[model samples]
Target: MACKERSKGDSRDGDDTWRNTSLAAAPASRELGKAWILKRLVHHAPAIFHSFDFPAFELGNAFEDINVQFTEHGYILVGRSQYEAAEGPAALAPTFAAFKDNLCSVLVVNGLEPVPHETVVESSKTATLHRMKTWRGEGVNLLCGAVMEPTRGILVAQQIADDDRWTYSATSTQRDRMLWFERVYLPCGRKCVARMLLVRRPTGVATSPCAPHWKPRRRGIAATPSSLHRNRLQRRGRDSREDGMLVRVRGKILLY
Candidate 1:
C-alpha cells in the first residue's frame, strides 16, 4: 500500500511517500504505479465551493484521481476525476449528480504541522458527530451538507453576504447532516500549505486523487499527493495506520 514516486520532470519534494487506500480494490506496483482507486467510501464530491479560493486552487492541474487510507484512528484523503483535462462527458463534473442528491460534504485540514490542529480529532465536535451518525455506505441518514476546514492552507472562503442566510440548519452534530460551514484558523505557511479541496465526481468513489499532478512532477500526496495532502492522521495511531485522500484547491474529503 505505497506507490508515490513520480519523476520525469521533478517538482521539488522528492520522496513524497505513498501507501494508502487499502483493504481491497488493489493495484499499484511498477514500484507503486499510480492511478487506481475504487469508489472511495461510497461517494461525496462535486464542486459546491461556495468559498475556499484561487478558482479553487486552479483545479490543481485537473485533480488526476487519487486514493489514500491510514487507520488506527485517523487518515483519509480521497480526491477524484478531471484527469489532466478531459476524456469523456467533460470528465464528469456537472457537480456529480447534484452533490449526490443533496447530501453534501467537503473537508480540509492542518493547523499545526503534523500535530496541533486541535489534535485532528476527526474535525472535532465529537468527531463530527460520530461521522454524522456513521454508515455512509449508502445511508444512516445521508450526510445533509458540510464544508469543514481544519486549517493552514489558505482557505479564505465564507464571504457570503446578501444578508447571508446560507443555512440549511441541522447542527446538533448530525440531524441528517446539514452544517455547511464550520471554520477554525491559525496557519500562515512556508512548507505546510497542507493542500487539497477541489471536488466533484461521486457515484461512490474509486477516484479523485489527492491533487497537484501536472506531471512536471513535484506535487504528490493531495495536489502535493493533494498539494501534498493533509489527511495525515497521527493523532493516536502512534506510527501511521493510514487514512488519506490528498487535497488540492477546491474541497471535499472523507476521513477515518
Candidate 2:
C-alpha cells in the first residue's frame, strides 16, 4: 500500500507538470500485508510548525485496517488497464513510501534541514493538495507541495536525470489545491544526491548555503538559485558528497 497523507480541501487542477509518467511495480511488502494504514488523523496543520526546530518524531505505527484512499492531483487517478492499483493505494504505499522517506536522510540539504524522515508531511487543511505522482523511469519525485496562502508560481515539478541524481522543485500557485506528485526515484545501490528547494510563501526564499543571498521574485521574474563559481569548483563541490554538509539558514525545510 502506498502511504498517502490526505487532508480535507476543495479539489483543484494539478499544480505542476508531469512527463514520462508511469506507475512502478508493486513492492514485495504489499504481498505480505506489511503496510502503514491510516489510524487516527488530524485534519489541521500540526502546531509543531509554529515552533518546529527540526524536531524528530514517529508517525504513529498503529497501522489499522481501514479503507485507504489513493488520490492524485486532488482526485483518484484510475489506472489504465495493466497499470491498475489492484490492492488500492496501500499495495503501492511501501514502494513509494520507501523511496520518498529515504530521500531526506540520504541527501544533505542546504539552508533547511529535513526532519529525520519527515515522510508524513504537513499541509494546511490541504496536505493532500501538496502530493504529486509522476514516474520518470525508475526514479520518483514522490513528495512536493506548499501552502497556497502565500502563493508563488508552479506548485510542483520533478525530474529524474540520467546522472543518477534527481531534482524536485515547487512554487506557490494562486489556486488552492490538493496535489500529490508520486514518482519515486531509486538511485540503485549508488550513492544518490537529492537537493530539495525549501520554501514557504513566494517570498519565503532560502539562501543557497554557499551564497547567503535572498532575492524574492517580482511579478514574472525568476529568483536566482545558488550557483558554484568556477573558482570554487573543487572547494564547493563537497555539498553533494556522501556525508551531508551544514547549510546556515533559518527556515522551514519545504517538501520536494
Candidate 3:
C-alpha cells in the first residue's frame, strides 16, 4: 500500500489511481454486508478503542474484519492498521484525525490556507480529485478507494511513509517524534512528508466501475507446502545479524 507516483496522463477523475487500485465494485446489498462485517470486526478490539465504557462501539471487532478483507484484497481499505498494530486501536482516532489534519497542513505548506475539514468533507466531486492530487504532491500516498458511507461519509486515501528515511531524527516527545521528520526536517529541507487522506463522497450512491478481483477458494485455505514455506519464511535469517531487524518488523505484524 506504499504510495507511488501515478503515470502521466492519469485522469484525476474520481477514477484515478486511488480508486482504481483499492476499491472493489459491489452491489448495494454486498456493500451493506461489508459495512456490517466491518462494524462487527471493530468490536473485537475493546481495549484499543476504550469501548468498554462506550457500549456502542467495538474497536477490535472492527479491526479484525477489516484485516481479513485487507489481506484478501491486498491493501487496507479502511482503518489504520499500521498504527493500530503498533499502538493499539485507540491509535485509530488520533491517527485518522492526524491524517485529516495533515491534509490541511499540506495545503498550507504549498502556500494555501488550510481547508476546513468540514469543507473538504463536503467537497464537490471534482474538488475531491483536486484535494487528493494536492495531497499526493505533498508526499501523501492514498491507498483506499472512495468509499461512500452513510455514517462516516466517503473514505479515500493511500498508505504512505517518508521516502527520505535517512533524514529522520529522534525526539523526546511523542508528538515531536511524529512531527519531527514530517514538519521540521522535511519541510525545512523543502521536502514533503508522507501522508494519506481519503475522499468522502455523498451517501446512498452507486456507480458503474469494474469489480475487484475475487479471492479464490484455494488461496483462502492453507495448504501443507504453502504453510511450510510460510513457516520457513517466518524463521529464515533469524540467526543473521543484518537480517534480524528485517525479520522483526515483518514478523511482528501478523498478516492473518
Error (Å) of candidate 1 at residue 12 is: 38
Assess candidate 3 and give its TM-score to the true structure.
Answer: 0.22
Winner by TM-score: 3
Tens digits of per-residue lDDT for model 1, 22-103: 1111322311211211111112122222121212333343334444343222223334332122222322333332332322
Clashes of 3: 23
Greater lDDT among 1 and 2 belongs to 1
Tens digit of lDDT per residue, candidate 3, span 1-256?
2222333464433332222212223445434433433332232222222211212221222211111112221222111221112333333345444444454343232223333343232222211211222221332222222222222222333222221221221111100001100111122233212222221111111111111231312222111224544465456534342122223333433353
Best by lDDT: 3
lDDT measured at residue 139 in model 3 versus the true structure, 0 to 100: 26
Which ten contiguous residues of candidate 3 have the minimum total lDDT? 173-182
The whole-model C-alpha lDDT of candidate 3 against the native structure comes to 0.25
